[model samples]
Target: DPKVDVLGLPDWVKFIFLDIGLASIVFTCILGQLTTQVNASHMMIDFINNYFAVFTLYTAMTIEFIGIMHCAYLIKNILSAVSGKPILSNEPPKTGFTFAFYWVRVLMSCAILSFCVAVVFTALLAGDTAVSVKYPSISPPLAVVLLLFFMGVVGTLEAMQIAFFSVAKLPPSQRGTNWFGSKTCSLLFDGNGKNLPTFMIGRQLTVVCSFFLVGSFTSLTIVPGTGNNIFGVSDTSQAFLNYGFQGAVMTTILASIMWQYAASAFPVTFLNSLISFILLIVALCLEGTGICGACWV
Candidate 1:
C-alpha cells in the first residue's frame, strides 16, 4: 500500500478525487448542457452533425501525435537507464531556429485572435434572424455580444496563463521553491532545451491540417442520399476527385512531412524540401492518373 502511493497520495484518495468526483462533475455538466439545449435550438445538433467527423479526425491525429511523443519519452528514459546518463540536460539549443519558430508561433496566435475578434464583430453586426426568432424576449445583438464577451474573457485568461507560465522564461530567483516555472518550461521544451516552440506549433499544424483535409473530404461524401458534388461530376464515387480536395490532401501531407523534420530538430534544407516536394508531386500524379489509389483523398 505504501509503495502504491506514487504521488505520495493514497490510491483511494486519487480514485475518490479524480476518478469518481471529478469525472462525475464533468458528466453532470455535460448532462446539464444536453438537457438544457444551450443554444435553445437544434443548432448544437446541427453543429455536431456537420462538424463531428472533422472533430473526430482532428482528435485522432492529436492522439497519434501524443502517442508518438510518449513513445519517444519512454525510449529516452530506457536509454538513459541503460547508459547511466541523466535524462535532464541544462544545455540550450545551438541554432536560432527554435527562437524563429517561437516568434512565428506567436504571430500565428495573434492572427488567430484577430480573426476571432473579427468573427465576433461580424456576428454582432449581422445578427442572426433565426437566433432572434428563437428567443423573442432577448435582443439578438445583445445576446451575441454577451456570448462573445464571455468567450473572449475566458480565452484571454487562458491565453495569458499559457503565455506567462508556459512560454515565458522566468529567472531562477522568480521560479520559486516549488519550481513551477521549470515544470512549465519543460512542457514547452525538451530535456536539451531544444525546439522551444516547434512541438506546440507542430501539434496545432497537425490538427488544423487534419481538420481541413478530413473535413473537406467528408463534407463532400457524407451527405443525405447521393452527396454534395459541387464539381459537376457524373459519379458520386468521384465526388472528391477535384482540385480542392487534392490541394487539401497535399497540404496535409506536406505539413506532416515537415513536422517530422521539425520534431527531429533538423533545419528544413532546400535540397530536402525540393526532394519532398518532387516526391509528393509524383505521388499526386500517380493518384490523379489512376495508377494507384494509395493517396486517395
Candidate 2:
C-alpha cells in the first residue's frame, strides 16, 4: 500500500495508462473523421468536411509524435539512471540545447503529418499518380528541390519557435530591465542569464530563411489551388487552415517533449532529429516516385 500511489496505480503504470488513453481518444476521433461522411453543402458539414477534418488529422498526428518521442526519452533516462550514470559529469548535457529541439521536432512532425493527410485526401477524393501527365511534369531535380524546400520551411519555422520559447522561458528577474537592451539582445540570443546562448546563430539564419520562404511560393499555400475551391476561395486556403491547426498541435507537442526529455542528453535530441529528417526524406522520395500515390486534382 505504501509503494502504490493514488488509485493504487504505480507511477509507471499510471503513465502507461495515461499514454494509452490519450492515444486512443485521438485515434478514435481520427477514425470517426475517416468513416463518417458529411454533406459539403451545409455550412457546419462543409466546415467539418473541408476544414475540421484536416485540422483533426494533423492535430492527432502531432499528438502522436509528441507522445511517442516523450515515452522514448523517458525510457532512456530511466535506463541511464538505473545504470548508475553520473548526472553531473564533466561533459554535462546541455539540457537547454536539447530542449530547444522540442520545438524542432513538433514542427517537423506537423509538416510530415499534414503532408500525409493531403496525400490521403487526394487519393480518396480524386485520383492518384497512377496516371502519367505528359503536358507539364515535374523533373526529378525539381522534385528533389521541392522536397528540400519543404523541409527547409519546416526547419526555419522550428528554429523561430525554439527562439521564442527559449526567451519566454527565461525568468523575469533574469531579463534586462531596459527595454531597448532586452529587445536587441532577445533578437539575437536564446538563453537566460546563466548559460551561454543556445542556437542564437542558427535562429538568426533561420529567421532570414523563413522570411524568404514566407515571401516565396515554397509554403503550403499557393495563389491558385487545384481543388474544387469550394472550401474557400481556393484549396490552398484549406491547406493554410490545416497549417493553422497544426500550429496549435505544435505548441502542445513542444511542451510535452520538453517535459519528458527534461533530464535527457544531447544524444536524444540528435536521434530524434535524425529520425525526423530521414522520415521526411523518405516521404519526399515517395512523392517523387509516385509510389505513395498522388491526390487527384
lDDT of 1 by residue, 114-182 (tens): 433343344334442223333445565675554434333322222322343322354533432333434
lDDT tens digits, residues 178-223, model 2?
A: 4443543343343542112222222223333333332222222323
lDDT, candidates in the order shown: 0.37, 0.39
TM, every model: 0.25, 0.25
Question: Can you give the lDDT of residue 168 in candidate 1?
Answer: 37
- Whole-model alpha-carbon lDDT for candidate 2: 0.39
Runs off by more than 4 Å, candidate 1: 1-95, 152-297
